[model samples]
Target: MASIDLYQIPVKEVHGVKGKKPEELLTLGIASVGDLLDYYPFRYEDYTLRDLTEAKDGDKITVQATVVGVPLVQMYGRVKSRLTCKMMADPLFITAVWFNRHFLKDQLKAGTDIVLTGKWDQKRLHLTVSESEFPGKGTSQIGTLQPVYSVTGALTQKWMRQTLKQALTQYGGLIPEVLPQELLAKYDLMPRKQAVALLHMPGSMEEGQRARKRMVFEELFLFQLKMQAYRALNHDRADGVAHPLDMPLVRAFVRALPFTLTESQKNVLAEILHDLQQPFSMNRLLQGDVGAGKTVVAASALYAVVKAGYQGALMVPTEILAEQHKRSLERLFESYGIQVALLTGSLTDRQRRDVLGALQMGMIDVVVGTHALIQEDVFFRKLGLVVTDEQHRFGVNQRSVLRRKGLNPDVLTMTATPIPRTLAITAFGDMDVSTLNELPKGRKPIKTYAVTHDMLDRVLGFIRREVAEGRQAYVICPLIEESEKLDVQNAIDVHAQMQFAFPDYKVGLLHGRMTPAEKDEVMREFSANRVQVLVSTTVIEVGVDVPNATLMIIYDAHRFGLSQLHQLRGRVGRGEHQSYCVLIADPKNEVGKQRMKAMTDTNDGFEIARRDLELRGPGDFFGTKQSGLPDFRIADMVTDFEVMERARDDAAELVRRPDFWTAAGYTLLREFLQREHITDSELLD
Candidate 1:
């Protein structure tokens, strides 16, 4: 490769000019041609112009003709400035215009040969300039392919254009190729530097797309390697929780239940049993849709631990959940004389010490709590089974550390979010997964219906009917207050109106702003049937399973994720009685109406999650943040499920190669190591 003149560098290099010093370019970290190539165009700088007669509305292009007349300033309204210039371009006359760019006031002067690139606002027959620069010559022979660089605060387009122009100064020479030889040939991938350069300054759209394909492949490859390493290091022998799957305790606990287990529950529980029998540690995810009877399945595992003479540790996200779980288990254990203790940060020092002492003494058969269960002072004498409620709510490391307290405790993680099957495989490759897809037997399916705010009166009438029938209700509002800053609904106003509407009955309010004690009191009131109506936020989603609460009315239901709405609906229907879920939505917004309709259509969480993913598109399903899952910027777990499956298989096979960690994958390793900000990497380090 030989160097060439800086002036002839591609348009992108000039479009990517950085800061004042060349050293400042060092921090921008243009370490590899791949790095530079991966940066995408913010928007198109389409200089694709049309002839005067062919120019349509909003056409961005450039034309060079002698400015036959002076540029005139035309201002309209309180804020409108337009620079229009009439020029002769042969048989047709062209009018070039610039908007609001007052600097162009002098630049588009009379008799100046100005080449303007702008959109043709056709209604006014004006070529409105988005940007303008002299092509250094009359547009008589202008270059057709122009580069548009993504601009940043420290770097102006002109500066970037200049700097990138400087880097590509040696236009005739190619940069060093970094991909391994065999892969380069096998995949038919272009030389690394050439691919990067092409992406930044492609001759055509097809070439740019091809470049994108290669870069996306590389990113996913590195991510695959990282996931592979994580699985290997975490799942190897001397690696798993050796479970004493004591069937006697499990059978006794199951037989004691008043209700029959749903086949789905039995099957998932059996899967957990099988995993316990394996030599490898039982790192399993129990994905149950909202109201899928996850608690009962967990109780079976806890019983097994106790019968096996080992302790079980169940951790929850909130103190209320911890206490609720403890109360449920305590009731279950009381039948068999088994012991369960609850611990939380709110516990008095003496009470905590007593719980900790009992735990270390092996006196506590099973322990349930918030983070207090994982404290250094809280040690289990022979802890073996660990269950995390709402696993997604806990950080990966936090979950791992809690598990670490025991002797390779078999970990049972449960989530209300029913992930699609494909994502479950890739994101949870190291963990065995069991899904409880059915509600426990005798549990009535909640009849769901969608209603607009206009139908609120009828919905309220139905609620009144339920109340008259001696049933309780939950009126869920999306927000806590009418934030002057946001347009969200607040629970305060809703509770006030319901209080007025249901003057014959008691109404209670609960929100995040309320203290734990306050929320607990409200839930208790509703649970005991003291409050006929509880108007609250999502706080009610995880409230105790009240058998008599038959109505769940959600306002602005579209504001919630489908999974969440399902959880809210699950709050009711725990009883033998038929339940109703009323979704109050805006009828005008067809999209919102459709989303609410879909929720009313099915109670299956997996189906809802799939539909929600489809409705929200994969790229934005997680709401624009890199999720807590694997680092796949290019391969979205939600969108690129097919690609992820292929990549996962390919990666697994790649690891089988004797020389996988050899020089062949050095660049891939370096790429994985670049993500150093990771906090919880025990799973996919």
Candidate 2:
């Protein structure tokens, strides 16, 4: 028989597998042998040999013991079962229990030899285990490190292990090495096949670590190559506008500002200006904390583009934000003879037609809108620059559609979410990034407080006082409705409580479930001082800028990520009034306490983002898909920063080689990138 290629074979085709179906395995993302092989373990268990008598509570151990009695199975909850039994090794007696695993009754018979691996709870006098099976025939392999995979649906860990073992045994010879031998030697890495095998069944923890390191490098290397390829494609042509630097209109707009720009703003403005003058399109990312005056820097660049006799479009994620930007830009550009128009979904058909006609006639110098700008009928007379606020909310395809409006328009994307420096390079390697690190003069920092449930009444009283002083406040809840599983506060319940507590003041409710028109109306009411208090979720975390909203109270704040909490706190402290952010929660653990402390310690978004990455790795930072990053199985952007950097450098060098197109592993790397949709450009656009 011809040797089977694991990548080309479906997993269900293997013999002796009867119960598992294609759809069941697909739930765990294992459709083929390749998917199964790439399905790395989320964690490893040290099943190494250890004395059962010497084990402490919560210590994982593997002990060889013979069953001493028949197992007794008992029903617990509606969907739970417990099986208990006694196992012995001479003087050592272990009471082991398995939950919801009724199949063990047949395999675990009296006088049967077995190796059990699980944690021991001495107080309960039971060994809480998930795995128990007949001892395999191998002295050295009796207790070795093992892989614990995350299986779903009808697929159990045993099924995954058995399937993978069969594939490795039957088709291990066909596992090709994608990494070059010289690169492997330089990194002191093992062969690809050996690494995959050792990762599944390692003799020691050291061997597992080595195998994991090689896999991490492979993931990072592939990602770096894709990013470099995208960058080269974006900058390869000089088909974009080179807006002139010296313009009277831009100088006038800057001079007309009420306050002087900060040094950081000036430096970033210079950087953007340089990119605007490049022959190729400008793909730059402007990052800063809340209230860091990134808007002004973007406005400066847009002003320059308009002065160069080209139209510009600023796309915000929300209609209210688009309207706000329109107002701000109008005030700044009115005296400079620039016409700014707002185009949002909320606009009437006639209104949209008027703006679209004006844009086609070159009457509108700048257009600000939400996703409505990317509509088919919307066209720019000469779109030289494209600015997007909160870039994460917009995908690469949406940005590309807008970019196609002009002949390779220079793109400037802005975000208030301050990503860590290392991750920024990884997530946005194709774009030149400039950060505004300082707040403009006269902007006051928000005072943050971490409070427990005991202080809730006091915090409510303070918010009442702030409202009485002619200021508005925001009350944030994590959930829209009460969840059976989560103990967090809901917006509806909190909104009712606020209304009942303060019957004299008008309280408004706003959440993600509300329509855009409804959200816009509520925000307008709050901004116009009609609503004394706004009860909402994190929907207001992004672009609602109310100068009078000086007080913020977040219930069950520990449920939010540190960076998101920072953004929530930023909704306030926008005006001359001294603002306060009260975070109410009794943290359940040290990580929660640390997140609360970080919020209270500093108002810096970047610092909070870094700490968030440390606490919850890169996966939860912005979610793997939304961040346009590969869902790395083992590589942590925090702990593996050095490894990622090395891989990135090597990938860059390899891509620049003269023979890169025909190099070894080039096809495999390209195919992997294509499979992942990394080169689609929709992610980076």
Candidate 3:
């Protein structure tokens, strides 16, 4: 047989994949032979032979036995039946029962030798057969490890296994090796062909683990290589603007601030200043807790850019956040003779045109807006700096488009949601990272507690007392309106309840369904203490600051992730007065309970983020689909963290070589990257 390109051959062309099987494979995302080969099993079933006498109750084991008597088939309902047979081992007799498998009666006869795999019930000396194989049958999977795949659309495990086996046997050798020989030898990695085969048909669990390690390393290595390549290209570009560091101006601006800068914030600002002075454009991510004072560091950077005779742009996710930042920045830089303007969709046509004209003509030193900053008509005279707040909220292309407004502008991305170190390196590998873990001085830790529905009255009383003391409070719900499928409190119902409970105080409602203007009005009232209790959904999860709000009561807290719960908790602790967070939930599962416990245990956002990653996995940690996190076929961000670090280091070293693309050992890697269209443009996007 002629060797074929696995990427070109369709699943239908593979042997034994006939009829609807081709369509079934398509539904599983197996378009070509290559995708089929990459569709690895999620788990494996160990069917190694075990002694029947030594098997304990509830232990899944495989045992060889002989049928001692005729099998009896008992019919129950229309489609339900039971097949029972007695099997005798060397010195033990066990009864095997197969529910809904009545056809097996024809296969089991007196004195027939069979191998059965299932849980052992020692009390009754019985085995519930999950799989059975006859010794002399046409094809037996008795004493071997079996691969269990995730199948759908009328696909069975047996059919999937058979088709994969045939495909591997035919095209396994033709699968090209993308990694260099030196790496393979240095890491002691299994060959590509051998690893692929072993993943599907490993001799033992150890072999399976080894195969998984090789694939994990490959996936992470390639991903990091692309990241390093982007970094290299950015550093080597000649269009990068080397912004002059005006230390005197920066010091004067810092001194004008009302509060002293924390040591952690100072160190992070130093790092950003250093990056700005370099010839290369600064592509950095600044991550901190909700009240960690990241805004000060960003303000300093923007001040440096404006003093250097260039413009800066600050982009945020929501209009409310944009308005807040603009007010804050205006207050910070007004003394330095720098002008800041706001641009958003809410602006009238005349207002938008005036701001655009001012930006294009070098009148405005800094512009703050939402997605409006990326509009085609929005141009900067010399866009020296681009700062995006809540970086995960914006898509990759959205940020990239804003960056393109300037000629290799120094970009600074900010996020209050602390990311795990492992995720930071993998997701933002192309950018330098600076973390601020310490909160500012005079900031007290928020007291947290978890309660059930029975404590609702006490919680409301606590909030009422706090509001009576001239402090504001927040009441959060999981849903904006009542959900038929989910049994959780909604914002509207809670708002009405709170109003009735505290008739003397004002209660406001907020959710995502409200217009931007309505939300702004509610938040404005809450910030001014007019609305003492604000009943809201998770829309208040990010960048809503009201230092007077000292109490937060979250309903159905189990529905929120740990990180999200942490963010909501941060809304209160901003004031000097002691703050509190009350989580009202009755979790039914261990994970939900753990999430609630993690929130009440500590106020550290990084620790909460780490726990959330472990509990929810990477995909749901922060919505990886929209966060620019790569999808790996086998690599897990939590379990394979060490392997990811190794891959990152290796890729960094490889990309630093001067002749990386032209080297002899890198030919295959280069070709692979080209074949997959992993170029600078695509990687950046």
Candidate 4:
């Protein structure tokens, strides 16, 4: 059968999947036989038989024994029951108990031999049975590694295992191998079919590990292949804009800045300038820690592009950020004759029309806006460059749409959220990365502390002292309003409490629930020192620059990821004065405590990001779905990073081959990509 036909076989057609079982399987994303085959277990349970004498308390083991008595079913509270049976394993007799499994009473007869797997209590000679099997019954799960899947309603692990076994038996042979034979031998990888079989039914833990390694490599390799293809296609495109390299003009503008640019910033700016001079469009990611002066580097790039007789568009995620960038860029380029305009959703209809007209007529040299810049009516006459701020906040399609406004315009994406090395190479693998590691001179590191709720009064007192000395402070809460489910403090209540605590100081509130105008007003007041203390939510987590703000108090700080806490801390320390961040949290778990320790230990965003990835995993680190990261079923972004790196290297070499896609050895890969709809255009998208 053809691979496509085999993949299209419905789950209902499988031998064991009947009735609502197909629907249940579908809920787990298994609609077809191919999906079922690819539905790998998230983990496995070991049922390898062990000697009863060697077992210790709380040890998960499987013991083979002969039933000495009939199982007894005892009714418990409110529809609950327990089934117990006495069994003899050589010199010792043990009792096995199953909760809510009363049906097992009829199955286990006296003198019947069976194998039971569960957690053992040695003193009581008891096994709390999770699984059991009769010795001769063909359905025995004993002495085998049991695959445990993540299932949905009515989809039990036993049923899933059986259905997967049936699917593999019927169609596993038809599953094609995408990796070439030479590559497999070089990596010492198992055959594709063998790996799949081992994953579902591994003989031992080592076998399972070997199988997992192969799958991880394959997933990473294919992902890197797609990224490489996108990069190649982007480079080969005919409509790329090769902007003029006017370094003399750009350097003069840089020289006129009030402060000297750090060596790291200069190096990164040089990299972006070089990309602008290329014949192909620039697709680059500019990453830096908070207050690392990414905006200045971006400004230089924008100056270079506008000087070359082209318009530029800067897209940010929030309206407040858009406005801030506009004002700063305008101030930066006032003497350089570059016109910067702000276009955001909050603009009046007449103001929006004027900005749109100016952009279309090339009157605006650089336009800063939120998603409003990507609206259908917005037009750019000679747009040569596109810069996206906090790039991860926007979706891939949003970025693509803004890029589409110009004719293959050079794209530069900037993010303050420092991405880890593993994610940088995989998630942003298609783009050239530039990092700014050094902060501007004389900038003091923010002092950080983790304290319990009892320290709240002291923290507030410290903030009052800072405010009394003419510095602003920020109080952040987890929620905008009270939530019945969440016990964390809310911005509204915090704002009131802050006002009451500091009666003489101005207390302002800002949250996501506020309209853009309301947020901008509160921010304006805070920026100008009219508001001494600002009580807000994470809405201020990004791009809120208050030079005079020297203190930040985060309530329930453990509720946030390390990177987020780091970002909030960044709001302060922007000026020459000393800054401090107080984390008011009573963490209940080791991971939470570790996060607090990591925050108090280092001020480095990169280090914090790495730790965040380890603690929260990739999904919660940056929200993989929104961050353009693929959801790998078996490959973990943390533990399997080395394998990913190897796969990336191999993929780069493979893509460089002259006859990569057309080669006979790559026939299966080509077909797989096609089947998955991974076209060159979609790869970049």
Stretches of model 3 off by over 4 angstroms after superposition: 1-36, 50-79, 84-95, 106-113, 118-128, 150-156, 174-177, 180-182, 659-663, 676-683
Candidate order, TM-score descending: 4, 3, 2, 1
lDDT of 2 at 635: 80
User: Per-residue lDDT of 1-685 in model 2, one digit per residue for the tens?
Assistant: 0112665788776554556567877887777777777888777777776776677878877777899988988987776899888988546777888999866888778899987877888676578876776766444335666578997777777667777788788767678787766689998999888988888877788898899999889878877887776675556567778777675656677777878999998889888988898888998899999989988888889889988889999999988788889999888777778999999988898998999999999999999999999999998889999999998788778988999999999999999999866677777668878888888888888999999999878988998899889999999999999999998889999999999989999999999999889998999899999999999998898867899999989999999999889998999989999999999988999999999999989988889998998999877887766667656766878888888788878887877776666765566766665665665644454
Taking the tens digit of each residue's C-alpha lDDT, what string does model 1 give over 15-107?
Answer: 344344434443554433333434445434545444656666676666665677777887777678877778764445677766776556666
Pairing residues by index, what is the TM-score of model 2?
0.84
**Model 3: lDDT of residue 471:** 97
Every model's TM-score: 0.81, 0.84, 0.91, 0.91
lDDT digits (tens) for residues 1-685 of candidate 4: 1456656888788897887888777777888887888889988888888998998889999989898977898998867999988999877988999999898787787888888888999999999988788888786767778899998878888888888888888888887777778779999999888889889988999999998888888888888877766666556765688897688888998999999999999999999999898878788999999999999999989999999999999999899999899999999999888999999988899999999999999999999999999999999999999999998889888999999999989999999999876687777767888899989999999999999998888898899899899999999999989999999999999999999999998999999988999999999999999999999999999987899999999999999999999999999999889999999999999999999999999999999999999999888977767788878888888888888888887877887787886788787676766655555356455
What are the candidates' C-alpha RMSDs?
Answer: 5.7, 4.6, 3.3, 3.1
Give one clash count per candidate, in the order shown.
15, 1, 0, 0
Return the lDDT, model 2, position 44.
Answer: 76
After aligning candidate 4 to the native by TM-score, how far in Å is the CA of 220 from where it should be? 1.1
lDDT of 3 by residue, 135-219 (tens): 9868777767889999996899988898899999888878878777878999999988888999999989999999998888888
Please give the lDDT score for candidate 1: 0.71
Can you give the lDDT of residue 159 in candidate 3? 85
| Model 3's TM-score against the true structure | 0.91
Candidate 1 TM-score versus the reference: 0.81
